[model samples]
Target: MASSTPQSVERALAMFDAVADAPGPVGAKELARRVGCSLSTAYHLLGALTARGHLTRTAQGYVPGPRVPALHRGYQRHLGVGAGVGELLVRLRRATGAQAYYTVYRGGLITVVDSTAPVSDTAEPFVPGPEIRAHATAHGKALLAGLPRPVRRRYLDEHGMARFTDRTITAADRFEAELARVRGQGFAVSVGEADPAYTCLAVALPGPRGDGSVHALSVSLATAEFRGRRGAIRGAVARAAAELVPEG
Candidate 1:
C-alpha cells in the first residue's frame, strides 16, 4: 500500500473548504485557482467529493450538498469550543436534569456545537450538531438576537424567513418582536415543536464590541419537566451563559 502525499491531502482539504464556504455555487476553474491547485488536481478532488455526496453539480456550477454540512458538523467538533461545550452541557444537564445544548452561529445559520441529556432516552431528540433553523430554536434565536444590528439585518435579508412549525416566528415584524424580548429578558425560550415536545432556554455568549458572537448555551427538557422546573432552569441557564462569556 502506498502512502498518500501530504501535499495532496492538504490541497484536497483546501478545495473542500473553499467549496463549502463559497457564497454560492462555484465553478471548477475558480475553485482550482482559489485552492492553489492545478486544474486537473482540483477536478479530481471535486469529483471525489461529489462522489462522496459532499458536492453536487447544478446548472450554474458545483454547490455543496448535505455532505458538506455533515463534514462541517464533524469539523466543528475539533474547534476549541467543542471540548469546552461538552463539559458545560454535561454540567448543565446535571444541574437541570434536562438536555443541554450549545450552538454557534455561522454565516447567520446556527450550528450545534455540542449537547447532552440527563437521561439516555431512545427519543431521537434533534441529535447534536448539524445546521438548525435559526428562528425555531432557542439557542439560535438567543445568539442571533445578540448579534450586531447590521449583521442581523444582512442575515435576515439573505435567509429570509422559513417556517419550521406553526409556532415559528416567520413574519419579520413578529420575529423582531421576539428578538426584542430576548434582548430584554437576556435569554430565549422555545415551546413545543419549535423544537418538539421540548422546552428550551438559551442565552448568548458575549463577543467583542458587544457585536455578539454566534454562540449560546441552551437547556431543554420535556415540556412537563420544564414547566415544573422553569424557575430553577432559567437561573441555571443564565448562570451558565455568564460563565461562558469572556470577562472584560
Candidate 2:
C-alpha cells in the first residue's frame, strides 16, 4: 500500500516516525541513518517537515513540533479512549507493583496508547505504536482473544506470527490453542515470551466500543517476581479495569 505513495513522501513520513519514537532529540545524521536516506535527502525532508510544523530543529537536535500534540489530541478525540486511562494506569501500577499499560486494537493493529509514567530515570517508558509479535505479549493476546475467530485468523494470516523470544509461540496450531486458553481463563499471561526477562498479565475491557476497537490493560514485572504474585497482580488489573468507561 505504501508503494503507491511517492518515495519522498514515504521517506518523509518514515523520518517523522523515527523522530517521534526516539527517546529524545535526534540529530539529522542519526535520523538520516535511521531512516536509510542520504544526508541531503534527510535535510530536505526535515526542512519540509519543519516548514509543515511536524518537527522542530533545536541546538542539540530535532524534536517534535507543536503540531504533534494537536494531532495527538485529534487522534484521542477520534478514538474516544485514553481519557482517564492515564490515571487508571498509575493506580494499576501502584496496586500491581509493576508497570501498567493501556492498549487498544483498532484498524487491524494493536497500539499502546498510555502507560504509567516511570518513577525513576532508569525505569523504561512504553512507546505508543503498532509493532510485531502479538502472540508474544499479554496485552496483544488479550485484545486478539476478544476478536471474532475469522478476524483473528485474518490478522494471523497477514502477520504470520513471528517469534521474539525462546518462549514465543510461532506455530499456528499452538498459538490458536493459547488464545483459546486465554479466552477460557478470562486473561492473557506471558512468561518472558516477548523479552525473556519480564512477565505480563492483561485483561480486556468489557464489551464493545462505538469505534469498534478492542481495549485492554496489562502489567509487567520481573518474571521471577510475577511468578510468585500472579494472583495479586491479576486481581489488581481486573479491579482497575472495572473503572474504565467504554466510549459510546
Candidate 3:
C-alpha cells in the first residue's frame, strides 16, 4: 500500500500551484477556493510561505518570492554553462533535429536543467512541468532506474504511478520490470507515454563525483518523425551521453 501524503504538505503545495498558475497575484479567498481550503487556512499557509520567502505579498496580492529566482539561479549554478552540458545539448539538437534536454533528479524531483532546439515557427517548444511524471518520461525513467533499489521503491510508494497517457505504465510490478530493463539497457525510450504526440529517448549521465544522484540527457520529437529515425536518434543520444559524462 502507498503511504498517505501529509495533508498539510498537500494543501501547501496546492496553494503554491494555484499561485503559480494565476495570471497575477492571488488573494486569500480565491486561493482558498482553488485549494478547497478555508480562507483562514489559506491565509495561514500563505503567511507562512511568504515569511519563508517562498512567496511575496504585494499591493496586488501574493506572487512568487525572491527565493524562487534564487533557487533557479542556484540550480543553474549547480549545472552551469561551464559544465559543458550546455554545449552537449546543442550538439544533440543538431545531430537529432529534435529538442535536446538535460535533466537531473534531485530532492526526488526530475528537473529540466537546459534544452536546445531549432527556432521554428511551426514547432511549439516543449515546456517541462514543475512536477515530473517519472513513470511516463524517458529521462525520468532513466533517472529513476539509476537510484538505489530501496530509494526507488520508496519514491514509487510515496508518489503512486499516475497515468498521463494510455501508454503510461501504471502497475507497480510492470513499472519495476521496465526500470529493470532500463538498468540492463543503459538507456530508456518512451513512445507516446507522457504525451500522445511525442516520443522521447534518453540515456543516464554520470553521477556527480560518483554520488548516487541521477542525471540524464533526452531528445524529443513528433511520434512519426521519431519512428522514421529511431535508431539514428538513439545512437546520437547514447554517444553524446557517453562523450559528455566521463566514466566513473
> What TM-scores do the predictions have?
0.64, 0.88, 0.69
| Candidate 1 lDDT (Cα, 0 to 1) | 0.75
Q: How badly does each model clash, as a count of residue pairs?
A: 2, 0, 0
For lDDT, candidate 1 versus 2, the one ahead is 2
lDDT of 1 by residue, 1-248 (tens): 66566877777777777776666788988988886878898889888878989788787888876776666556664443644667777888889987888777765566776667433555746556555576777887887898777888888787766776667778888888999999999889988646657778888877752224467788777888888888899999888777774432
Alpha carbon lDDT of residue 166, candidate 2? 81
Candidate 2, residue 168: Cα displacement in angstroms equals 1.4
> Where is the poorest 10-residue window by lDDT in model 1?
74-83
Worst-scoring 10-residue span by lDDT in model 2: 118-127
Per-residue lDDT tens digits for candidate 3, residues 81-200, read 236777888898999999998777766666777778543433533454443577798988898898887888887787778888899999988988998999898889989888889999
- Which candidate comes out best when scored by TM-score? 2
Q: Estimate, for each residue in 1-248, the C-alpha lDDT of model 2 and write its tens digit.
A: 33898889888998888888777899999988987889999999999999989999999899999899888777766777757777888888888889888888888888887767553444453456674767789998999999998888898888878887889899888988999999999999999888888888999998787667888989888999998999999899889988987874
Instruction: Give candidate 1 regions above 4 Å deviation.
Output: 1-82, 117-122, 209-212
Q: Write out the backbone clash pairs for model 2.
A: none
